[model samples]
Target chain A: MAEMAASGESPEILFWVGCAGSFDDRYKAVTQAFVKILNKVGVSFAVLGPEEACTGDPARRAGNEFLFQMQAVANIQVMNGYNVKKVVTACPHCFNTIKNEYPALGGEYEVIHHSQFLQQLINEGKVALKGGGEFKGKKITFHDSCYLGRANDVYEAPREVIKALDVELVEMKRCRTKGLCCGAGGAQMFKEPEEGKKDINIERTEEALSTGASAIAVGCPFCLTMMSDGVKNKEREHDVKVYDLAEMIAKDMGI
Target chain B: MSILPQLIFLLVFAVAGYILYKRVSYLRRNIFLGHKEDRNDMKEQRWKTMVLVALGQKKMFKRLGPAFLHLLIYVAFIVINLEVLEFIIDGLSGQHRIFAPFLGGVYAVAMNIFEFLAIAVLVSCFAFLIRRNIMKVDRLAMKELKGWPALDANLILIIEIVLMFAILTMNATDQILAERGVDKYLAVEGLFFSGLIQPLFQGMSEGALIFLERFAWWFHIVGILAFAIYVTYSKHLHIFLAFPNTWYSNLQPKGEMKNMSEVTNEVNMMLGIQTETSNDPPAEIGRFGAKDVNDLSWVNIMNAYSCTECGRCTAECPANITGKKLSPRKIMMDVRDRAEEVGKSIDSGGPGLEDGKSLLGDYTTKEEINACTSCNACVEACPVNIDPLSIILQMRRYVAMEESGSPAQWNAMFQNMETSFSPWKFAPTDRFNWADQLKNEEAK
Candidate 1:
């Protein structure tokens, strides 16, 4: 943002690198993959760099309205200062909170998830993929993130992006509107789950793995983390791999 | 002396009407005990949702077999009530088959349809009974429904079966009497189900037939009135509440939790941010979240009443499926139960919300609310659009803000978010370090 302002130039969009995309070691690779795609498509974008703060999704969902508002107001201030008008993020948590919750705090912008952004790029003939990429004709299962699918009704975009890779997509028994959670929402990711016979992440992972797909695709950073943990728990990490939608697209495009 | 039956019927009808009125008012008063929530926007959308979800039974169709049987019973409930309208008019005007003379053949066709639906209701109720008892469907057989709830479900089915029999018996005996050319009896024929039972009444004496017919007529009307009164108390209230419940459903994207405007204003003031739309008076800081029934919105309370304990929500709940303490259905049941408890206490001049017990500890435990992933499967699974997750979040808000009672790990996480703008202890400056490697890769 500072460089753009110093050059008296305005970018077309702002890349919201959420806390997971910025700090989580595993999710940072997803952030890089998505950025490479943006560069490949010649989409002018600016990042907040050091100025962005958390969107307080966990704080609000954890029931701390005060903390949530504090974080929201602070973030709104910086974004408004930058005159940011369009934003995209790879994290459903950040995507949901900022897209839905920010307007009320005097910050309004058109926000799209990375899956939707990728689908648009593909639709506009910007990002072309290899006809016989690694995922071509291979079975891949797409796990619906609660925020993206049921929360905002963005079910088809991510699946469309995956189908563009020329792969056959399989569905779990529970998918779409009836999609199950990965046990990490509502701040459950940061706390020990209450006593239960089995963890929720395992239950969801078992369903995903039961689809007989060698690869699982996810849309949210939180879901990616929980599902990866579940795959490791089942000791099937060697057999099955998880990739974010952007990562898959980036890999297919050879960006 | 002929007016004696009409007089008695009038008295019975009056008493039943009075009881129904009282119950409806009681329900209204209790539902209004909660705070107000404005859901009246998007008028056209609300109607469309009500039509698709409540009237269309759209969500119930998620499971095929039960949904089919439920459709049968639901259709029976609607079509058979048209026949009840005839019964009501007959009992009031000292007439028999009043609509029969007016519509000529249409009445017989309608009665035939009613009989077919009555038979359908009987068969569906029997299937449900078997599913609930012998088949032991996992959702219906959960421990949450062990006692009164279980009995309530079975009792409703049994009552519906008995009511159908009453209607069928009246039709059958009336047909037999009509064959004997008795006065005030319609000479209806070609009745499908009733015809099958007509032979059972063939050998009866005229007076015996008359008495049996009169007895069934009175039994049918009175039982119908009694069922109306009983439904308000039973989970069967869904029949009525489902319409309004679906109408007032949360229409925003399911991912968006409502922002607390009071907190927003306070935060803006603390930050010294100026805004143009600050004309409203400074808001008072009410309870941060729902601590009891009254702290919740009226829509939240009504959601509790609209739930029918079908266990669809519980069955789909990841926490419950994983053997956790949280059952979304039970959360709704608990809220309704607590609302009733508080409403009753206030009626009797008791301490009401001050009765020392709460929805949190006494009805729902901290464990149950904490176990929720906010996945919204339960919300989506509800045929009537009951939002148990909203109530759960409200209570969690109470625990975190009012009592500071979240678990230790959550408190640490909260501290991390407050201090470092993330749930983990990482400096905000490192937020962009992930891009450093990307820069290096690009340089190559």
Candidate 2:
């Protein structure tokens, strides 16, 4: 973004590499997969790189409104400095915070989740899927992130993208608006869950496993990590794989 | 004189009306004790939401069987209440079937429809009771509903059944008297449900039939008045509040937590940034989040009262489903409990919120609030759009901001977020380090 601004040219969109997409070892792959799709499609997107900051979603949700505003204001200033108008992110947390919460704080943009962006790219015929990818004919379950599904009502876009892979989409008993949480929301990823009969991720993963799907697709970085941890807990990691929708799309497109 | 019965009816009606008014006024006063919020925007969307959710029972259809049963009761509640208007007029005027004279045959048809609705209400109430007691539906049978909530659920159903019986019995005896050519018994026709039981009164004499019919009449009307008063104190308050609650629902996306403009101004002033200009003075930042009921918004308090305690929220709650302490239903119940406690205290000329107890420690626990994943399944599951998550978030805010007593791990994450831009301890320069692998993949 800084280089583009220096050259007096703005990219088509600013890729908001959220904290998970940037720093988390596992989610970084989701970031890379999505970027590969973007590059292959020639979308001319630029990341904030070092200039990006947390959207204060976790802090705000944790009830530290002061910290949340500080982070939101700082991120807003940086994005506004770049004249950033459109944003796309793989993390539903960042997407929700920026799209819904930022407008009240003087930051507004056409924010799109990577799943929606992928759906748009596919509809426009920018990204094409192979006729017979490794996932074709195999059963895959899509876990709805609370932020993306119930929060924004973006249930269909992600499912449409998954169906484009030519894989049979199996739904958990609890799916769409009634989808179970992976238990990483509201800063639960940073801390241990309260004592319970079972971890939420395990509960969610069991639902996914019940569908007999070989792959569990997710839209949020937090969900990806939690579902992956859940698969490991069940020792089904060797058979069942958890992935972000972007990663699956990128792999299907052979990007 | 015949006016004697009229006088008794008037006295009962006035007393019940006054009691209901007092209860309603107390509820309104307690709700307003919470801080104000501007939900008046988006009149069109608010109307649509109220119509669809509260009026149309849209969300209830997510579960077909219960939704069907609930719809029967809901429809009966609305249509049968039209008869209450007639009952009120008859009670005050010392007349029997006042509307009967006005509409003639139309009145009998209306009466038949009302009878059918009464039977529907009876059937629905019976099904609900069976589901609660015999079937032991997990959601309704949860530990949160072990006491008054459980009794309250059964009591409302039993009352509705008894009320329906009163209506049916009143119609049956009135039909019997009209058959015997008694005066003022007003002839009616096509009363299906009540007519089915009319034969039981065939052998009764005139005086006995009149007494039984009059007894049922008083019972039906007085039972309705008492039910109206009792509803204000019960979860059945949802019948009245569901409209306003759905109208004033948070129209924004479910994931969007409310922004604190007060915090925004403070942050701007501290950083020397120009805040948005407004003629009104900067609002005071009272205790950060809600310590008690008063610190929350009026809509939040209304949400508490509007909750029907159906346990749909608790049933779908991820935390509660996993055996965690956080039942979203319990959160609303706690807020309502605390508000009622404070309201009663102030009424008695005692310290209200300063009674050495808070909603946090005394009513709801930090364990319960902390257990929430903010998954919003509970919010989505609410038929009337009661947002228990908002109350949970407010309590969480109180814990974090006022007490600075978030769990130690959360405090560490807060510290890390303060120093670095992220929740982890990584430097900002390394934020895009993950993208470096993209260039290597491109090289391949």
Best model per TM-score: 1
Report the C-alpha lDDT of model 2 over A137-243, residue by residue, as the tens digit: 99999999999999999999999999999999999999999999999888888888898999999999999999999999999989998999999999999999998
Q: Point to the candidate with the largest lDDT.
A: 1
Which sections of candidate 2 miss by over 4 Å?
A: B276-280
- Tens-place lDDT per residue, model 1, A1-69, is 879977998899999998889899999999999999999899999998878888998888888888988
lDDT of 1 at B350: 100
DockQ of each: 0.83, 0.85
In the range B11-55, model 2's lDDT, one tens digit per residue, is 998898899889999999999989989999999999999999999
Error of 2 at B202 (Å): 2.5
Worst 10 residues of 2 chain B by lDDT: B434-443
Model 2 Cα displacement at B155 (Å)? Answer: 1.3
Q: List the residue pairs that clash in candidate 1.
A: none
